[model samples]
Each structure stands twice: as C-alpha cells, then as structure tokens.
Target: MGNLIFLSGQAAIDQIGGVVGPGDIDAQIDQAMANIERALNAVGSGVDRIFKITVYLTDMNNFESVIKMRERYFDKPWPADTTVGVSALALPELMVELDVIATRP
Candidate 1:
C-alpha cells in the first residue's frame, strides 16, 4: 500500500450497473478501459502510471481487437501485461475484463 495500487478486475458494466455493450467486443473493451481509468483517477493516479495489467477475455479470437484497443490507452514501454482466455466471466454477457497495478500519486 505504500506506492502500489492493485485494482480489481474491471468489466464492461457501466456506472448504472448495466453492461455497456452486450455483444460488441470493441465497445466492451472501451468500457473496461474507462472503468480502469475511473478507478485509478479516484486515487489521483492515471493510466500512465500503471505498471502492470492483466486482461481476461471470454474469447481468444478477440485478442487482436484487444491489441488494437490497447494502443489507444498505452504508449511505448507499456505496462507489463498478461492476457488470459476464460470460459466465462462474472457475467455471461461480458466479453472482456481488465485489472491493473499502478503507482499511487
């Protein structure tokens, strides 16, 4: 807790408790990233300070989409990352989930 922040897995569920995108992978990825940003911002940190990230996906075929979307969030020397393909997530409708470790500001 000194300088690191461990965030729980963030899914596509929005601020209102509804999935942001039911069957859209790209939209889901965006929402999950937004959620991650929100969590980090709440503590005075932002995505630029993330040191590591773990991604979960219900379908490995969507990995390419994740890669493309990731470029929008992180730049060169990106955070350490690990992506896993799971059979399902907390909600069946969810397609992607992201969790990250970042430094506190």
Candidate 2:
C-alpha cells in the first residue's frame, strides 16, 4: 500500500501556529489551505494526490467560500469532500478547519 497522509483539520494558523484571520472565514480558509499544502509537500505529496477532505466550519454559511478556495488548489477530477458545520472548534478565532487525506508519491 502506498503512504496515506492524513492531516488533522487545519485552521487559519500562521507560521508560529497561531490562529489567524479571526472572524474572516476567507482568510482562515486561505491559511488552512496553505497549511494543508505544506503538510502534503512535506510528505512528498501534493494537492493533486489528495483523495479526500473533510471541512469543519463554525457556520454553514461559509460553504461557498470553501468551494471557491478549493478551486485554487484542486482542478478537474476533484477529490471527495465533506463539509460539516460545528458550534465551536479548538479556538474561537478559527472559522474553518480542513481534514486532508492524500496518497504519497
């Protein structure tokens, strides 16, 4: 079996791992995607290999925003995805978190 890289839900965290963008879901999503990219790259994989992702959001209202951001990373034949709304997260500042599953190169 190939390496399966499972990334815990990532929030809008900065280089120091501090929650960023606060109430800005767009910014948070951006950071979360970037974090996901870093994690995938570290393991010799990339977004192209991402087979699935589960997104957690403080509010379901940001669903479209997440989809828009996904376009930035994924193209045709996008990965399987699931988005859920939650009342809270590990931090109040985090508006979005992404659960990533990718196959290693």
> For each candidate, what is the lDDT?
0.90, 0.87
Residue pairs with colliding backbones in model 2 are: none
| Root-mean-square deviation of every model | 0.9, 1.2
TM-score of each: 0.95, 0.93
Error of 2 at 24 (Å): 1.1
| Segments of candidate 1 deviating more than 4 angstroms | none
Clashes of 2: 0
Using TM-score as the measure, which candidate wins?
A: 1
lDDT of 2: 0.87
Q: How many clashes does the backbone of model 1 have?
A: 0
